[model samples]
Target: KCAQPRRWKAFDGKITEMDTQNSLRGKELLEIYRSINTRGIPKDERTSVLLTLKWTVKEHECKLTQEIVALIDREIDLMSREVKECNLEGLRKRICTLFLQYIKIPEFNPQVAGLIKVPQDPLKLYKNVYFCHSCEKYLAPTEFPIPANSHTIGRCRSCYQLDNEARQREAYFKYRLILENLRKSEVDYQDDSKIVFLVQLPDMQYLIENIWNCQSALSACSDLYDLVMVRWDKQHEWSPWNTILLTKEEADAHLKLCNLQKTYEAPFIYRIEQKHIRAKNYFAQIPVMSSFLHRSSNQSNAN
Candidate 1:
């Protein structure tokens, strides 16, 4: 009988040789690996890859690292829906490597285990140490104030606060409260993927003070606590351009507003649109806001 060909080949002197690593199929797989984190791919393919990854992780039932499993599960759930972004490349590669480590090689299985050892004491390595970019020091995870749904590791909360006070001289306590309330009210909104985290306290202040002129659009109320930001179009995500600042009572009325064309005058509609355009122009400077804008534009185009 003829000898079976090896699935992988040794690295040859030539980069273009038909060795395992140099083969066209191997290059294609590498290209896929590189693109696993890229954003321009179609959503269906992205969804499929994540789903297959989750299934593979489940099938093996690997116990060495629940971290990868947990991350995979989270990404799968997050990417299953049509959202603005999917940036989980680091987690994806970590998952792939761990999965590869478990594959039984003919004679190198023990060598793989040696390289990727199952820890003798797992708890020893899982310390919550995080490096604060602002302070240039490693601190505990408690030093940072990460959002509930965010994978971003940011500067330490102390450093963030210090910078905000010293440089920005901005008050975020009120904005923080507003964000907390908004996130808490997500159940009522039915969609919880708004760009709330990207909107800094300073940005909120700008939108309120400069854009909306520190008063409710309807009642002209100036009390910051009494004023609340709500969606202009209830079906769309609440963004700077898509929001209206109204007093507690006015916000209640606005939320219950069903027919805008009938409820408000033509002049009022024109004024609100003017405010939206102003907000769009103002927030367009922020890079993160572009994704929300893109998402909004795509939705509008689809409709």
Candidate 2:
């Protein structure tokens, strides 16, 4: 039979080669080691590899290294006893955690600098940082959602997620998709539309669910994906007040109408106008939106 390679060369050298070649971190290696059953390996071989790892980690003199070394010694002591494998699992996990910490430090593991999330510059670390009242932690601006009409910062996204899971459970994704489609369509029109850009996600949700009752004005289509909000009078630019909810097919036909008065009955037009008035009443509260509302009303009166 062929002779087996020494445990140090087989395990320790293999780990080092993996770290050098694939840039595998200690945490990743720990996960890989845990996935396999180490019980099949002899105690002497395991101890030999662990000793080699201890010597390699000892090269760095730090508080983290000291903790890792102490845990390794404790693990070796436990292995020498008649304790069950389950009893040693906890100690092994602790050693793995400390070693991961040791490997994360750029001073100990220079290869991890690129992988670390924290910016090295102190100025960059503090820039755009805000405090989340709910979580009581400092986080980046991206971690908090600032609504278009918001005057103050709210809790972080994680806190909002926890709150929503516990309470609201609102699905606003459909409204978001609608708003996105509206913005893209407006951009394609090249009419220099402004109101759609100012309209936020919550506003769209209210417009669909409350003002329009989540149905097409003409066909009463309830499918949100097939529905779109378009200008009631194609001559005027789209705004909350001047918009009508219709299926895509209906919108195409509605936009082609040269005269809304000639194309629709007085009662049908009156009903749509009532919806427009409600939209105006709701959106006019927004200071910026109020200006657009006044301008649209004036333009409609002039026409």
Candidate 3:
């Protein structure tokens, strides 16, 4: 006798692929198999398979599941009657989204718990969490713009962005890029430069807009792309007071100068010194910088 073609004997008697595909529970398993196997299944067939799998997942019997299942059934009915794929696009997307959310729940799908990122220690999870007033959400401290001098945690970066859009509409991306470049350059210098890292986005914006007037000090070039902030005097490490805004070409020449006093006229040197004084006065307001200023004064007195 020929072997029964891949047949399984159930307690009732026998089970075949056709028998499994016809029953409701067996149809769900078949749909899952088709969803997982993408070799020859068409896009629409795969979508329908996924929709079937979404409602059939074990241990997920809730009102939300019922609503989604109803929606999927209605879409299937409409597709059968008219087959308008365009009209069902929105419904398909909603079903897929709901299914994704359904799978992400650890209770609904215990297998996914290891795949998702969650703090192993529950106590540590809340340690660095901060409250964002604007969004009224508790977020990580990294989400907030906490400057060196910030005494209290204010609104998060997202809230600040929303506030900017509503009011100032000012873009700080260019300034942020400039500040990052400055920090990287300072790190590469290998000198014990302390100020650039301490400076935040707002400080960089203030130095550029208020002190330098958003132009190259030497050539008065208004373009920010060609401009770079570098040490005014090569012997000293870069600080707010010791830096100059110059075009890339001008910066190379400026750094190469044997003597700034002789290379540039007295009037130009005087103007640069005035800008340095302004930077010193502005940054001195910070408590950390105040100590630095005090140490420098003591060293100057000692010398």
Candidate 4:
């Protein structure tokens, strides 16, 4: 396949029609390998193609990299969803926390790194890895966060976040509908009468989603609906998850945890505004929120 250019000239020798097609396909696949941390084609002859792919070309690497990242995200999502039945609550949290503390990956690593064999399936090398939080599947334990208590055990963080977000979203919508009904049922009232949207998820998996979707609920709920609290319900059916609710401090903490906390100051200084963001320790308590109470007043004032 590495026929010299001079040889190609004889038959259009290296640059012949068939050669052109082969080169095109090779270049494209090499580009893909670059992003997923791989190079070359399956056969030994093609392995060095990507490494040889010229990098001096402008924008070529970047375009391929973006596509690669997106592809990785899709794969991770599917992987995180397969283990939803695992109810080992404490272990999940510990593993996630530990991972956060120790999992210092460079954001994304090509799965094909260190791979020397041409397996029957390359995707399998990536599957069941990246133990992120969620109900999906995983290929390796390292993909997951290391447990806080142990060195080897891991769980999928993305799955955990997704499940948390879903539950929070449901509660947000349900509470929002109730508030809208209340507003419609009311006659003109004084400022003292306000509606609140309170939601609590039973685990971390659902809380993140609720927070992510809060903007929709905030806009739809009555203007008087100034307060919203969503947390994991500690009730029997959902006792082992994260909670959501209107805690001045804890709520903001969750937002920060989900990376949704807003910029209040020009300098961008921030805090765990939801009043401690309800650390794992607080999971057992009945988080309370009343319309008259405001925990995030400090943050709002700063903003």
Candidate 3 lowest-lDDT run of ten: 18-27
- TM-score of each model, in listed order: 0.42, 0.45, 0.44, 0.23
Off by over 4 Å in 4: 1-136, 150-154, 188-303
TM-score of 1: 0.42
lDDT of 3 by residue, 15-61 (tens): 75433212333334434543544445555775567565655753478
As a whole number from 0 to 100, the lDDT of residue 67 in candidate 3 is: 65
Best prediction by lDDT: 2
- Per-residue CA lDDT of model 1 for 168-259, tens digit only, reads 43346666666566555544777875576577777887888788897888888887767788888877777888888887788788889888
| Displacement of the residue 206 alpha carbon in candidate 1, Å | 0.8
Rank order (by lDDT, best first)? 2, 3, 1, 4
lDDT of 4 by residue, 202-253 (tens): 3332433333233222223322234334332211111112223332444344
Best by TM-score: 2
Q: After TM-score superposition, what is the CA distance of residue 240 in candidate 2 from its true location, in Å?
A: 0.4
Model 1 stretches astray by more than 4 angstroms: 1-171
Q: The CA-based lDDT of model 4 is what?
A: 0.36
How far in Å is the alpha carbon of 65 misplaced in model 1? 85
Residue 242 displacement (Å), model 4: 30
Better structure of 1 and 4 per lDDT = 1
lDDT of 2 at 128: 68
